[model samples]
Target: MRMAQTPAAADGSSGDGALGRVPPQSIEAEACVLGSMILDAMAIDQVVQILHDDYFYRPAHQIIFRCLVQMRHESKAIDLVTIKEDLVRRDLLEKIGGQDYLVALAEGVPTSANAEYYAQIVRDKALLRQLISVGTQIVRDAYETQDEAPIVVDHAEQSIFEIAEQHIGDSVITLQDLLRHTFEMLEQHEGQLITGLASGYTQLDELTSGFQKGEMIVLAARPSMGKTSLLLNIAENMAVIDQAPVAIFSLEMSRNQLAERFLASHARFNLRQMRRGVITPETWTALQTAAGTLETAPIFIDDSASLTVIQLMARARRLKSLHDIQCVLVDYMQLMLYSGRATSRQEQITEISRGIKALAHDLEIPVIVAAQLNRGPADRPTHTPRMSDLRESGSIEQDADVVMLLHNEDYYHLGEEGYQPRGVTDLIVAKQRNGPTGSVPLVFLKDYTKFESATFGVEQPLGEPMADAPF
Candidate 1:
């Protein structure tokens, strides 16, 4: 013979009944959580961090648990007597069925050892409830608003992202755990050739350790200083050589234009010749080989001209989910728009920089962003860029983990006697949070619009002169 089921139990509804249908509640799990907390005072330390009062399915349980948390927060004991007194002082004792129900709760659990298990069940149900709430709000907004479809979609994405972040519990790690993980990584890297991703440039990789994860690296330079070319070089190296997935957000150039530059760089041919359809047989053969190589490369490009930071984050998240992109490169920072309304350009840039940094941290990947330096570098005697020369310097310099400025001596010392540093460029590491700051010498191939590692021999001019160079 079986006992009859209560109305609430049969319908899986809470006391409030406001949810209408079952809204993903776990009453038994909630009772176990409370029982564990009351049974063992020390169990509150763990359960308190995992759950809050609102997670309870019943209003009475919510009231009781709220009292328990308040008592614990004030360094009070968490036993039955102390919790009852705390509830009484707050006038919630009778509301929660008084001392009798509290005693029943403690007696309901077999032991407090399974507290974490019960808490997990409660958390999962809470997450499902939050999802339902977010879905309901999205539906409401869709029906009530006459806004653009993309704007509504962005709102929905932002809401879901917030809920996802909230559900990412227990992110904190102890120092001992970090140290152990670091030691294991070092042990694995002991006899390995390279630890981080290879930049394909020996000296630059030596300096940067190949753009570590969760780092925001800012590559800034004046116009025609080969910033875009250097970014493309790194992208090609990572995608084609290492077979890593790479995403490039080109705010300035078209996808086909970027492809043309890549072919010229890869085949060591003149970009102008390819653009003008004046290729020789050898050049055509090399072009065909470069095209084949690129066709198999793991690279993705988005050439949206007026992209906002919010849109960029949404797209990057999608790419990360769909393709597992290992690295991301934004063509330039100044072209990115701030999603929020700003009173000045500086404010907009600050918001954009902060948002990019947040995106890098959230995705746990390296984000390389190109920026333009102010004219202050040109006015200086040496024409070397400083951290202050970064346009909208305040936020960018503060948020970037590493700031690299590109300088071409050939661009500044044009037509000077004995000034033959043609195709020579300096990658000034002006700011590095975890490493030394210095210059990494590189060679800029003028004709192909590419950058390569500087070799140790007598420097020879390659390809066409700077007069006909297209940036």
Candidate 2:
């Protein structure tokens, strides 16, 4: 075993006490980690997994670790002599305390067995320093910012989250490492009917396998095409039947209006009649029962009239941490506000779309966002929406893992010749990043404002509205 040296200020006290208080650091641990890496070539791999070069508080240590990593990547042997030669070749040996300092580091650690532990100590201190720095910046922003309070608060939350995410370690992996987890996932799904959260539509679930985690699913349609209804129905299925917590952000509708729609759909009553004072005793009983069921369902709604993507993501992050929500649904993307820097409306939509996709990935949950199609569909003869018809920006289609365009033929050709009123709506899976694309038919009950699989033998509500219609 080598004798350990008494630790000294590796970089001569620059960052040690510059901020009034001593910054968090473990100089001895950093030295031990470096020494172990030099002592055993195998220790380099283990230590790199736990600590990056920037984790070292001393600039000299940072340079040395970075050189060691580069040498490893270049398939060079790592030892006290070779490290010193490489640093000299790079003209950094003198800056990092020269050949004597390298020898001291190599002889400072007893063994390479504790490299990981030393690396972890360095990492913990680095995280503490980062937290203090972020906290200081947040205080400065709070005390001297022209931005609104909400914007400042969002910035603070984002900075802390960035630090927390850094502690999650590296996400890159070799195919060999990935296949192990892939096989385990396959084993878990060996006999499963659905590998992801089911949409309660058999045909759609068969096509999608279910809405996958870390996916952005775009449900697009023109106005009055029942996209919101379908979004809510999927939310109901996930929250109520699948027993998964769901977060709904409705920028277009008020909470009371959404609640009324949910009640009408659940109770199988005419939405217009329910809205008016034409409810019967049976209707009241059914409404009460449906309300009771929804009251206990893990369906949380945020009907913020205006929300930027940053604010939306912050809320979703908080919801996931608090309730472990499995999915998020955002109603109609075009209505989303973007207060961030942007040159054009398309740019704003692009940022919002990208942000939503990032939110889904960061939270590891499926995010279903309702979006609008352009009038290109209306100008066409068959009125089918293409992927190009996604309104505002093409980024919506680019960021989405799956794009489903809702189309109801009856809405366009209700009283036309040779038109059949089956109340069938086609959910066109226009773009699917991982699966096959096709149209899944759903039966839309206009009276109840509900949607279900068309494969079922239930009578389709077609043609004219009921006598008490408010349309």
- Highest lDDT: give the candidate number: 2
Global lDDT of each model?
0.81, 0.86
RMSD of each: 6.4, 6.6
- Give the Cα-based TM-score of candidate 2 against the true structure: 0.82
Write candidate 2's Cα lDDT for 180-251 as tens digits.
988887797676557889898888887789999999999999999999999999999898787899999999
Off by over 4 Å in 1: 1-19, 69-90, 139-155, 167-176, 191-198, 276-296, 392-394, 416-418, 457-471
lDDT of 1 by residue, 400-428 (tens): 98888899867888778887665678887
Per-candidate TM equals: 0.82, 0.82
Model 2 error, position 26 (Å): 2.2
Clashes of 1: 0
Worst 10 residues of 1 by lDDT: 462-471
Error of 1 at 340 (Å): 3.7
